[model samples]
Every structure is written in structure tokens, then in C-alpha cells.
Target: MEKNKQPKLINPAELFDPGPYGFSHSIAVESPSTMCFISGQSGGVGENHVLADDFKTQVQDALKNLHIVLQSHSMTFENIVKITLLIVDHNQEKLEIWAEEARNVWKSSFLPTSTLIPVSQLALPGMLFEIDAIAVKQLAN
Candidate 1:
């Protein structure tokens, strides 16, 4: 049997289209399913946990880590309903890099609802980007 998919997205009238930015304005979940709130995931790998230096690399690594977590739970990017992004020293360039990374992850129409937060610092030094997600893997009958 096939698994149930994520909720349907709704883009109603009177709102500016967010397509160019590779995200939807909102996501609506109306069915019975299991929602998972993932903790913040940062862009670090290996035993030493070395972080990426540049903005783009950090964003990519962060998303890769998030992917690993989702895969462990039998989920994928489609299972993600919302994403909260935290970035230190954020600027328009960083935002563009982030949007590019996001576009590279999810399909053109499957961008999860997201919120970008600019923070002064993170739990660790040299941490440029951190991301957490809310995913729903629909329960079977």
C-alpha cells in the first residue's frame, strides 16, 4: 500500500504570490495525522562537528542534516509542513542564498511554510545557519 501524502496547499485571493521566492504564503493541514516537531538542526558534520564557513555552504549542509533526520522517521521533504530558519548576521545576500537552497531541496510547488529569524548568535560559535521543521507522516488505516 502507498503512504498518505502531506496536506494540500492553499493560496487564496488578495495575497501577493510568493512563487518567485520559492515558497507558499501558507499551508493548511486538515486531516488526521502525526505531526512531528523537530529540534533545531545546524550545519555541522562529522565527529568534530566542523561548521561551514560561507552562507551558501552552511545553508546546504543544514538542509542536508534536516533531510537525514526526516529520513530516519520514514519521511521526506514532502512530509515537512513548516520550517523555521535561524540565521546569524542575516542580510539580503544570505536570504537569497537561503531561498536558493530551499528551491534546490523541495519541488517548485512543494515549498513548506517557513519563517526566517535573524539572530545575533547561536548555541555554538561559527554557526551561521540553523533550521528546524514540523513534519507530518500520515498514519495508516
Candidate 2:
């Protein structure tokens, strides 16, 4: 699979621009491709697996962890086709923070397809935010 291959991002003209919401309406992946499914990553780190007390901090750490996994496979944010975000206490303020962080990572390019879920709690006690992704790379014949 080639690292440079990117999925086609689509956003209908009739629908409102989703960039501010931190996602695209859909992404089209070409055939003969390999997909990497990453499990949900949270802010907890180190041997003790401690989560940050602040929501924004946890969001930042979670993204850093996601980047680590992507780099392991030689993929970047542009290669990501889909992502699912889980927020412990989803709100407008937190949404804004998450969107800002996402924009910082993706820049001006079309963002990946995303689904944000508001959850009462996460797998870990102190965890406040989690993100998982699906990335694609074209396979050579």
C-alpha cells in the first residue's frame, strides 16, 4: 500500500459546510486498498495510566496517541477516511475545543468522515475523550 494515496472527500453543496464541525459528509476509498482500523485511544498514559483532569488536555493527548499509531504505519492525518469521537460530557464548549484541535491537525484540507458520540463515561474511569480511526492506503498490483 502506498502512503500517498488519499480517499476522496465529499461534501454536498446543498448541505452546510461541515468543516467547522470537524468532519466531512463522506469519503470514497479506491479499490485494491488496505484499511487500518485503530482502536479507541484515550489520554491515559505511562505505567499508571493516568488521565488529565482537564478535558482539553485529554483531547490533546488522545490526538497525540492517535498520531503515534498512524506514524507506526507510515500514514498521516490525510490518509484517514473515518474517525469516531467519544466525549464523556459532550457540550458546545467541548465541541468547539475538539473542532479546533482537529483543524489544527488537518489544516485546510478536507477533513475525514467523523461521528461524535456523547457518552456518560468511557472504558477508563478518568478518561474524558477518546478517538478511533480508519485509514486507507492503495495497494500496488
Candidate 3:
């Protein structure tokens, strides 16, 4: 990969396309790059850490929070190579909502590879979803 080359998202011909499910099969990134591992972000808003009751709202807020963290590092969603989602009491409806929300955020055909884990609970109460990401930015030198 050349300098400033974005990571390559690979969805093998044999494997099914995961974009509709909010992920990719794999991502390949070359070195001479900076990799940022963002911590889990919940749907909490403001200094008080208020959480939304609904899953969809929580997913949206969590994505926004993740973007804020990425922005702090001078990066954006395009830099993301992988993500992990933790959903409380996850179900079909929740999956659909996640897929919709993810498609809304990621517009390109290539998307970050992701793993979704269904959990019984989270660190904060009323937290329905949490997302963590690994982003890579190629260096100029």
C-alpha cells in the first residue's frame, strides 16, 4: 500500500457480502500508518451521562460519540477499519435497526469489518448499545 492509501475492505467472492448486515468480511491495512483504538462508547450524553431508553436512539448517539472521538484524532469514519458492537438483549429488530443506522453512516460500498456481541447488560443502566472502533490513517512520509 502506498502512503495515504486507505485500508482495503475485502469481501471474498465466495463469502456473502456483509454490507447489508453492517460490516465487511475483512480489512487489510499496510504499515506507515497510525492506528487508533477507541474505547467503548455508550449512548450517554453530556456531563451527566444521560442514556436514551430506546435502542435506535442509543445506537445513533453512540455512533455520534465515536465520531467525536475520531475527530479529536483528526480522523473520520472512513479511517475506521474495524468495529465491535455490544448490544443488550439483542434481537432481530435491533439488528435491523443497527443495519439501517450503519448504512446511514457508512455510504461507500466498502465498510469496516465488525463483530456484534449480544450481552445481558452494560456498564451503565439503560444503555442499550455500545460501539468501539479501530481506525487507521496512513502516514505522509
Candidate 4:
């Protein structure tokens, strides 16, 4: 028996185009049993928070925090279907660095749908980047 063998759900092909310029190969869930919406995460480590002004460092910290949140629900990046990245200064170099980090974290098995947005500023004055994610747990029938 297959896990996602239910009938009444919207098909992925109808909801999203599989081949698009910026779209990934991830399938959007029709209806998920559990959904996790993570808040925008930054690179700050402490309670008072000393954020790294560097873009790569900020990306790293944000990914780390994302991992922690997913782990709490016994989930991993593989379960993540969508991710939105907000950057204060979006650049080719920063994107390259982020791609490298993403490869390390997500590995080859799963590549979640993603979106990157360049913003003028964030909530924090010195914050360079912020990342938020949406994950759904695929349960067996």
C-alpha cells in the first residue's frame, strides 16, 4: 500500500507547473496531516543577540536555527516543501554561497521548493539575511 494513495486530493500537476524557471521539482501537498510554519530566523546566537554582519555567516546561522526547529517535530529538510529567503542585499556571490550551504544541508535526496527575495532592510538594524520555511509531515495511510 502506498502512503499518499488517497483520492479526493488535488493533484500536484494541476496545482503547480512542474517545469518553470525558478520552480523546483518538489510536489506541493494537497492536504497535510501536520504543518509547521517557522518564523523568520536570523543569525543571532545569544538572547541579547550579536548578529554577524557577514552574509554567509547569517545564512549559516539561519539554516542552523531552521534545523533545530524541524528536529523538534522529528522533521528534517527533506520534509520541507517550501522555503522563502529574505536578504537585505541580494547578490550573485551571496546566492552562490547560499547554494553551497543548501547543498550541504539538504543533500541530494530532497530539494524543497524555494524563493529568494531581496529586501532593503529587516526588523533588525544590522541583520543581513532571514530565512523562513514551511514543512509538512507525510504520513502513511
Candidate 5:
């Protein structure tokens, strides 16, 4: 009689449903090969670091900071699986405008799972928004 052989198991991240809200509940849940957690990235650095006081400039700077953190770990925006955004003032118009900027940066790639939280203010008085993210590197077979 020949012995029976078992197949190997494979696991990958999966997004959960968020019901009729039209958005997913969870982003991904898989045993990550490597996980990276980026700190909340703000628009400016030092007291005199304020570049562009406008919303568009702040958005651009935040994205640039995100890229810097990703680059430090040999990754890019495409590798990001989830993101959390904190906005100082919550408005549909502002969100729409910010979406445009985000689209310009992300391009045609699939948008990462995200959450936008409206807040009264940030740690810094002049700060308008802050963004944070989580990413995982898929292992090669």
C-alpha cells in the first residue's frame, strides 16, 4: 500500500465586507512576511518648516513624507495595504478636493483601504491633516 500525501496550505490577506455602507470592514488579515507601521506624518517639520499654508500643499507634503518612510524600508505606495487619515475640518467639498490630489499621486493603481477621521485639530496648531499607514511585503515563492 502507498502512503497518502497531504497538500500544503497557503494563506493571503483578505478584505472583509462592511455591509451596506459601501465600504469594506477590514483591509487585510494574513500572516505577514514583514510588517511596517509608519508614524503619523504631518505637513511640516520645524517651527519654520511651514512651506505651503494651503490645503493642497499640505496634502502634497504629507504624501511626500509617506514616500520617504516607504523608501527607507524598500517599499512604495503600491505596497501599502491600509491608511488612516485625520482631517482638521470635515467637509465634503474638502474631501472631494483631497481625493483629487490623492488620485493624482496614486494614479491608476488600486486604492489602498482607507479611513478618514474628522478631528477638531492636530497636535500642531497650523497642522491641517495627518496620515498614517500599514504595509506588508509579499514574499516570493
Candidate 6:
């Protein structure tokens, strides 16, 4: 999948604002393809066994990790159908940073539906951000 692949973005006019706030109301996926689920990816630096301290960097690290998993199946960010974000030490500033990074990653194109969760802690100490995603790609005949 290309980073700019066309995926359905569902945000009804009647619904509350989502895009302006860095998320879509929902993402609709057309099936008949292989599905992939990535486990929660944190900001841990691979092979270094350490997590990034800053919120923005941590968010980017998680996305990079997610990209690695998606690429293994020939998919890209556009292949993502849904995402769940876990943020430790949740706050407006942290959310703003996360949203900004998300907008940067997707640009103005469609975005996968996302769920944000505020938590007191994560699977590992010092993990500030984590993300898990679901993706799908059409099977070649």
C-alpha cells in the first residue's frame, strides 16, 4: 500500500468536529483482503531497550514502529483501518503534541479511525506513548 492510498473517511456533517481536532469520526473498510493486527508499539528504541522521554519524539517512535510492522506486509499508513493510542501522563499539551504529529503523518489525506486512551502507566516503565493498529490489503488474484 502507498502512503496515500484511498481509504474511506467517515465523518458525517451532523457529527461533532473530528478532523479539525486531528481525527476522523470513523473509517470504513471494504473487505476481501488480508487483515493484520499489530500489537501495542511503544516508544522504546529497538535494541537499546529505552524509551524516548519527550512526548513528541515518543509519538514519532511509536509510529515508526507501526510502519515497520505494516511494511512487512507491503502496507503503509494508508492501509491502517483503525488505531488505538495509549498515553501516559495525559494532558492537553501532550494531546496537542500527539495530534500535531498525527496530522503531520497523514497530511490532509484520509486518516484511520482512532481511539485515544489516557492511562497512568504502560507495559514498561518510562513508556510515554503506545499505539496499536489494524490494517488490510486487497489480495492479488
Candidate maximizing lDDT: 3
What TM-score do all the candidates reach, one by one?
0.75, 0.75, 0.77, 0.74, 0.71, 0.74
Q: What are the runs in model 2 whose C-alpha is more than 4 Å off?
A: 1-31
Ten consecutive residues with minimal summed lDDT in candidate 6?
10-19
- For model 3, how does the per-residue alpha-carbon lDDT over 88-137 read when each residue is reduced to its tens digit? 99999999999999999899987999999999999777889989889888
Relative to the true structure, candidate 5 reaches a TM of 0.71
CA error at residue 6 for candidate 4, angstroms: 22
* lDDT order of candidates, top first: 3, 2, 6, 1, 4, 5
The lDDT, on a scale of 0 to 1, for candidate 2 is 0.77
The CA lDDT at 50 in model 4 is 70
Candidate 4 wrong stretches, greater than 4 Å: 1-32
Cα error of candidate 2 at position 36, Å: 0.3
lDDT of each: 0.73, 0.77, 0.79, 0.71, 0.66, 0.74
* Clashing residue pairs found in predicted model 4: none
After the best TM-score superposition of candidate 4, give how far the Cα of residue 73 lies from its true spot, in angstroms: 1.2
**Candidate 4 structure quality by residue, lDDT tens digits, 7-66:** 222112212232343433232233545566665667765545478879899889888777
| Superposed Cα deviation of residue 134, candidate 3 (Å) | 0.2
lDDT by residue for model 1 (1-141), tens: 124556444332333343654654334343567566666767776545578887788788877777766665567899898999999999999999988888888875977899999999997799999898888877787
Q: Put down candidate 2 lDDT per residue, 1-141, tens digits, no spaces.
A: 345567556443433354765765345455687566766777866445578999999999888777766765567888888999999889999999998999989985768999999999997788999898898877789
